[model samples]
Target: MAISAPLNTALRAFAMLLFVVAIAACSRTPNAMPTGVGNLGPGGGAPGSQQEFLVSVGDRVFFETDSSNLTPTAMATLDKQAAWLNQYSNYRIMIEGHADERGTREYNIALGARRASIVVNYLTSKGVNGQRITSQSFGKERPVAICNDISCWSQNRRAVTVVQ
Candidate 1:
């Protein structure tokens, strides 16, 4: 059976109203938490959470396999983060580089070093003082997540931004 235009229009309006009400009922602000930073995996962070890290004393950030390039998306993400770092010049930032479990320890260390240096270089270009930023290589020593798939690999491959 075909519905009349008026009834169909009313039904759609009611459905839209329910959705808006449901979303409004569910929305709430999250409580702030201290940045354990890399001590805790990314879980440690809530969406939109900003945690400060000191680059001194060795910050731990990881990278992907044999690559020093930050992905375009990573660069965009880092740009906002770098802006924050630049805001607080007193705080030092150490970007720690890490690799996956598949490589030799030494090889991973070199790759991790490259990853951290790349971040430092980018930060320098962005007007962040080189003296305020430094880097270290954890190589494959730390794994935020460990699994045989890309999901696990992605977390393991990171450069942590530490502030002190």
Candidate 2:
């Protein structure tokens, strides 16, 4: 369903708040911020190791329908990521929460937050340090596409686990 304009506005505002907070969280070096926020890939990896954090093998997780609770699939994904993090103890990460463009904007933003936190909690439970994982919700702001179809909407409802 298309979102109501009021809800959309609220969600946009929440997303803006989250964007600002995320920017501030990674504001250590002026140069480091862009690498993390703009390029969700391996932009911050060591030289010649740009592909290090590209979510290769198992680095992120996708959620089921409208729930923030992780399914077995998501659990498995995080288990792999947890193992990866354990293998590389010094690695840090940023869990970006996103929502598909199918619900009220504010509600979607809240759902996104819950989803990201779920992943964060799962990782921490599996031995990854909580401090190293920062969660942010983008609601439906920066969609990869603007289509209203279910195909596009399903893809939009996701939480991307990017390395820092």
Candidate 3:
């Protein structure tokens, strides 16, 4: 019951230091990977998996309003997709075309179909087997971003590649 003043102070300091160290040990850096888990590679999926293809090779391409033509940027993404598809030939892909909620239902459906067909054609021309790819149109039935603004409309106009 009679600890010396110096001893008491030292013990308190030691406890404070331990607390600080424990907090530091438990805190993780923003970029630190989890322990015991090996690297998941790009996109956090096994190589050649659908997840890898979606993340690493990109799964979607945006289109201009009322246009099914592929822009240079879209072409670049498609190029990467073609390379990945070629490397993973066992996978079949379905290109889903979507249009912004601007035109009539029939018009949007036709536009979406054109968008999907364009992507299929591009991939086939790049050596991906046409037989391995199919295309469908969602038209305006599906909108990834549902708002009247241009931002949402732009996002809705896209073709997404689904790998099976």
lDDT of candidate 3 vs native?
Answer: 0.91
Q: List the residue pairs that clash in candidate 3.
A: none
Candidate that beats the other on lDDT, 1 or 3, i.e. the better one = 3
- Per-residue lDDT tens digits of candidate 2, residues 1-164? 99999999999999999999999988665554444324543444443232554534355566666878787887878887787777777767888888887778998899889989999998999999887889899888867657878777777777778777
Candidate 3 — which residues are off by over 4 angstroms? 1-39
- Candidate 1, residue 115: Cα displacement in angstroms equals 0.3
On the 0 to 100 scale, the lDDT of residue 155 in model 2 is 71
Better candidate number, 2 or 3, judged by lDDT: 3
For residues 97-160, could you state the per-residue lDDT of candidate 1 as single tens digits? 8888777999989988888888888878888888887789898898888889888887787788
Q: TM-scores for all candidates?
A: 0.63, 0.65, 0.78
Provide the overall lDDT of each model, using Cα atoms, as 2-decimal numbers.
Answer: 0.72, 0.76, 0.91
Report the Cα lDDT for candidate 1.
0.72
Q: What is the lDDT of residue 140 in candidate 3?
A: 98
How many backbone clashes does every candidate have? Answer: 17, 0, 0
